[model samples]
Target chain A: MEHEKTQIERHTSKQFDVELEDVREQVLTMGGLVEQQIANGVKALIDGDSALGEDVARSDYKINTMEVAIDEACTKILARRQPQAGDLRLVLAIAKTITDLERIGDEAEKIGRMAVHLAGKDRPPSAFRQISQLGGHVRQMVRDSLDAFARMDTEAALAVAQHDAEVDREYEGVMRQCITFMMEDPRTIKHMLDVMWSVKALERIGDHATNISEYVVYLVGGRDVRHLSIEELEKEAARAISPRTGQ
Target chain B: MEHEKTQIERHTSKQFDVELEDVREQVLTMGGLVEQQIANGVKALIDGDSALGEDVARSDYKINTMEVAIDEACTKILARRQPQAGDLRLVLAIAKTITDLERIGDEAEKIGRMAVHLAGKDRPPSAFRQISQLGGHVRQMVRDSLDAFARMDTEAALAVAQHDAEVDREYEGVMRQCITFMMEDPRTIKHMLDVMWSVKALERIGDHATNISEYVVYLVGGRDVRHLSIEELEKEAARAISPRTGQ
Candidate 1:
């Protein structure tokens, strides 16, 4: 009887592991969808493709649906499996990660909306070159953050978090250029405001990605790195992964 | 022996209720702090009180600490008690609600930061009248959302959610006025941009408040009201609370 019970317990534990893995995979899938949204949203804006922008905006519902589905799965896991310690943290991190992902998706949709709004206006001479560059940088950050999450790599997470500062600087540069354009021609103010909104969305996307990286660190390093400096995060990550810690 | 077992189970369940109540109360306390932060942040900007703005920015750490502590407590409760059904949803909603509250606090900090940046600039004759009005509107939304959460009043939550549209309109008005100011005299571009940032932050705080009210609807109504229109949300809330449903 004892042997039989142990076998049953082992099988249940294995099933729980599978459930956790399934949730993590779903989160990655959702991240991929959001990344595509950001890319298409930015492309639509820079290329003045109203059809693509509308498509991108319409597709945001998919991300929102995934977020709700994934959150339900996590809640079910917590209720049924009663995850403890590391497992509990993993579930919690994924829950928080999806919220950020959903918000990133929202920002991308805002970019798409801005693109549609700007499509009717005359394109400026710079043609949003700076926005294109910043968009690429923010997109890379989102991808890298998801990569860190997929691998549960604390070092990679820290790197992505640190890269947000560069994204901020790029965002500021875009804003300055928009202001200059608006000043040069008062007629451009309305159009430039649309561009400003798009870049602001991209900048916010970078922040959401940084938030996801912080969750990765929290999951892998067992530390809440939300408000910490990059240097502080690095030290915490090192301590978490050190040989003496036996993590 | 059966009677004794029942008594012990009852005691455990009562303790669980106390734990849940404690977390809820803590969330309300945190909400109160965030509300104060928004008031002070906006007041600082409107009055050009650098000291007050600096204090609001500095005090954001308290909200962060509360968020971390509340999240940890929720995790512990989930691990130890494994609350089921309604209890589980309550815990999950609180978790999500606190995330929004923390973000609202972050927006208030941004407003405070912008205030500090603008204190050195020449105040425009209009003196941010639109921003002050929008600030008051958003602060009320935050308060009403928290009140709804505290009472689990779906009608109140829906009202707060609907009020966000007015906040958005106000935000747009401020943005348009800022553009006019910058266009009239390019020299004011820098200061106007600072004012614009503050208004943007206020707009986002309204969004965060809407998110919180949505959570209240989810928790009380047993439905994910996110991405739903106010009309649909009202229908869901009514159905969830209907006597025929026997909730």
Candidate 2:
């Protein structure tokens, strides 16, 4: 009877592991879709494709639905498996991650909506170039952050956080340029605001990407690294990866 | 022996309830601090009080620490008690709510930082009044959302969510007015941008508060009302509060 009980426990554990993997896969799938949404959303803006922008806005419903589904999955797993230690941390991190990802989708939709509004507006050529640069950087961060999460690569995650500062710099530069444009010609103010809001959305997308990276670090390292410097995060990552290290 | 086991189980359950309540109280305390921070941050901006702005920014560290502490408490309870059904839902909602609260703090800090930047910058006189009004509306939403959480009042939560639309409208009006100010005279561009960013932060604070309200509704109703229409949310809330009544 003891042996039978042991077998039952092992079977339950294996089932829990499968469920955990399912949750992880669902998150990755959502991340992938969001990445495309952001890339297309920004591209639509730079290229002045209102139809594509509308598509990005409409597709958001799908992401929201997926978020709810993933959230339910996490809650179910937490209740059924009663995950402890690392398992509990993984579930918690995944749950938090999907929330960020969902918000990223919302931000992207905002960008898309802005794009739709700006599609027919005549704007300075420099505006599109600046947006393209900022959007490209943020989109790369999103893609790489998702990669870091999938691989559970703490180093990659830390690198994403560091990249955020560069995005911030570019964002500020765009804002300054927009201000200059607005001041140079009163007629440019409205369009400049649109450009400004798009870049702001891009900047927020970078922040969300950084958030995802932080969650990756937490999940793999079992340490909360938020509000910590990159240097501190690096040291924590090293310590987490090698518990025997005295650092 | 069985009787002794039952008594021990009852004791453990009681202890768990205490721990859960402790987590709830900590979250409420954090929420209250964040609400104050938002008010102070915006007031500092409107009043041009750089010292107050700096204080608000510095105090964010305390909120951050409290957030981590509450998060740890939630995780500990989850792992130890493996609460089911309503208890588990409450813990999950509390965890999510604290994250939103922390972010609301961050938004307030952003506004505070902007306030510091705009300390002596001259802008149109109306900017401050508009900002104060927007800030007041958002702050009230934050307070009401917290009250809704404490009482598990879905009706109050729904009201907060409804108020967000008003906040959004005010935010757009501010943005438009700021654009007009910048357009009329090039000299006001820089300071107007500061005002725009501050109001943007306020808008996001409203969004976070709405998120909290949605969580409250979810906790009490056991249904995900996210992405639903206000009418639909009201219907769901009613159905949730009285499960036997058919919607």
TM-score of chain A of each: 0.96, 0.96
- Range of the 10 consecutive residues with the lowest summed lDDT in candidate 1 chain B: B238-247
- What TM-score against the true fold does each predicted structure earn? 0.96, 0.97
In model 1, the clashing pairs are none
Q: Compared with the true structure, what per-residue lDDT tens digits does model 2 show for residues A1-247?
A: 9999999999999999899989999999999999999999999898889999999999999999999999999999998999999899999999899999999999999989998999998867786788898898898999899899889888889889999999999998888888888888878788878888889999999999999999889988877888898889889778667854454
Point out where model 1 deviates above 4 Å: A124-127, A244-247, B124-127, B244-247
* Interface RMSD, candidates in the order listed: 1.3, 0.9
The sequence of per-residue lDDT tens digits that candidate 1 reaches over residues B113-164 is 9888887777765648878899999999999999998898888888998899
Model 1, A1-247: lDDT tens per residue? 9999999999999999999999999999999999999999999999889999999999999999999999989988988888888999999999999999999999999999998998878876564888888899999999999999999888888888889999999888878888887778877887888888898999999999999999988988776888888889989889767854674
Superposed Cα RMSD, model 2 = 1.9
TM-score of 1: 0.96
